[model samples]
Target chain A: MTLTTQQSKEAEIGKKANHLVLVVTNDTIDKVYPPMILATTGAASGMDVDIYFTFWGLKLLDKKGQTQTKIASVGNPALPMPNIMGMLPGMTAMATKMMKGKIKKYWPTIPEMMQQAKDMGVRFHACSPTMGLMGMTDKDLIPLTDSICGASTFLDWATDPNSVTIFT
Target chain B: MLGTSLATTDAKPAMVLDTKGLLCPAPVVKTSQAVKQIQVGDVLQVLATDPGSKPDLTSWSRMTGNELLSVTEDGGSPKVYTFLIRRMK
Candidate 1:
């Protein structure tokens, strides 16, 4: 290929490769799938993927909390009515318990998903403020956390021109 | 109305990923890895379950600009889901 042609080809290749995504989730089991799925896909597509787990989302980092993460079905209009009917008075609490069972039946445990995310080289960040508020220390979180930072720190990573920020 | 199998097959399948018994991130994760090995225009066949794969595949295909040719259930295993994906370079 000629020099100009080669340069054009290189530019074309560069354009195809540019992808950056920032996923922020607040620990809702049902809500966690979006960010995890998006981040995994981004990394798979050769894009730089960063996931910022803040507030309740940070629970994924907690070894115990991750395995015990529950889905809130009460007041969540999305829960199937048939399933909701099974929950009596404290439906929210019952739904959470039932949802957890359903989730466990369908897919890998949250910790396993975390391992997969790490294996895919997806960057995992835990929010420091949330950690403090929840009274959780680094010892409580998964060992793979890239770092603990505040919202401003996450914003710095999300400001790139190619970065697509998503709040889940 | 036409069956999903009859849509089109002029292109060759570039990769085949068997994600049976795998859940959520595994299917997408494996598909992503498989896509990396093929060039644009190549197709990838993914077989998975976990229900979440449907939306996951659609969203990933849309996000990566890949063509999701088809997604069907394989009968042997009641939960089997298959996806035909064409790489978009």
Candidate 2:
């Protein structure tokens, strides 16, 4: 076959392969939602989805952290309030509550979304080195945790030629 | 916009999903779940109030290889979108 035909054939194959890898590196509620949303929706769309949680994002793998994640009012340009207002004692809590209220009105809670993702076969990867850094054990992680792995293993999973990898 | 297929426009749906008051990804996710309960070649009708569902469901139906048979819009206090999707696989 000609080079042009071969390239077109390869593109056709790529279009048919459905795999998604999301690398999550932040723990703030705003950051957490993107990867979780993508993972759940991607899996629902019949794609194989893998979410790798590292650094601050690893906190979400634990039940306490999931329950306690706060929305970042300070240094958030998207927030309509002044930065100094965010520094006030109750602002963060208020912001978190307000956002969660809006989110819950339209979509399922974070825990519910996680449960749906798990039910749909989306894999969750906990960063092993970060686990050691945080001094967390497997038992401390949520039941949704599929594996504790390093960067290299997660990278290997992202190396599929037909897969799409995202960082949030 | 992807126009309704002439042949399937009047197709009877096997199930109906109500996603009123829900937004964004929820409608698409629920529709995906509803689609699984039916046999291939069966149609699933989805009713949603979120304006975003128009484009979202279109893209979803295309990505999943499910045929979007028809889309109807009704003007109201909260606009309603009705989608008829057929499971192709």
Candidate 3:
């Protein structure tokens, strides 16, 4: 295709700035919230938001995992606890479960959140290397994933001046 | 002995940011957007309920170089936090 001078100029202006996000997580239930929250807000703020799901983060792309994501609470550092009680074991899992319940009670399920992200035109990218390591195929991921790419590709997308590279 | 009390008042333009019923990132996100619309030296009042706002707003103020005048509880709701922010150019 050939581009006219005006068209090329407009394209350059449009490409001058954007926001990019890298969401890396493997923490089961609570893992999906950070990326989804940040990406959705970024889009709302008139920025281009790209989410790269890799390694354990890839679990968020799994249709099955989306239905069962939960928040950890038992031993979560973020949770307020007495100094002596904070040292208990298995607290994280309990906290995760508690958090999961709280979230489910208030917001939509992870699957619904994924669908909302898709509806909002957020770009979801699955990590090709992670897929290979985990023995997952493209078909195993949610339909929202636009492509499977590498770190270099993500870095390139984040090169613009207005781009805010966030690791959620 | 008798004592008398005196009352004093000060005038300043106040801005309101209603972030109630919203969650993390939303409150901060909305607050950031609202702050952009005000002039330097203007004061903004933000109402929110997200437990994360304390740190979020604090950090946002520090990073953006704005002034956080105060953060107080609203109507006794542990989650209902109000912030007085002074816009800094």
Top-TM-score structure, candidate number = 2
Q: What is the per-residue lDDT of model 2 for residues B26-88, given as tens digits with 9 covering 90 to 100?
A: 888889899999988788999999888999898787677677778999978798899989887
* TM-scores vs. true structure, each candidate: 0.66, 0.89, 0.57
Model 2 chain A scores worst on lDDT over the 10 consecutive residues at A1-10
For model 2, report the TM-score of its A chain: 0.88
DockQ of each: 0.24, 0.35, 0.07
DockQ of candidate 3 relative to the true structure: 0.07
Ranking under TM-score, best-scoring first? 2, 1, 3
Docking class for candidate 2: acceptable
iRMSD for every model: 8.4, 6.9, 15.3
Please report how far candidate 1 places residue A64 from its true position, in Å.
3.6
Please state the error at residue A57 of candidate 2 in Å. 0.7
In terms of lDDT, model 1 sits at: 0.72
Instruction: Tell me how far candidate 3 lies from the true structure as C-alpha RMSD in angstroms.
Output: 12.6
Candidate 1 has which clashing residue pairs, if any? A26-A57, A27-A57
lDDT at B37, model 2: 98
Work out how many backbone clashes candidate 1 has: 2
Query: Could you give the candidate ranking by DockQ, starting with the highest?
Result: 2, 1, 3
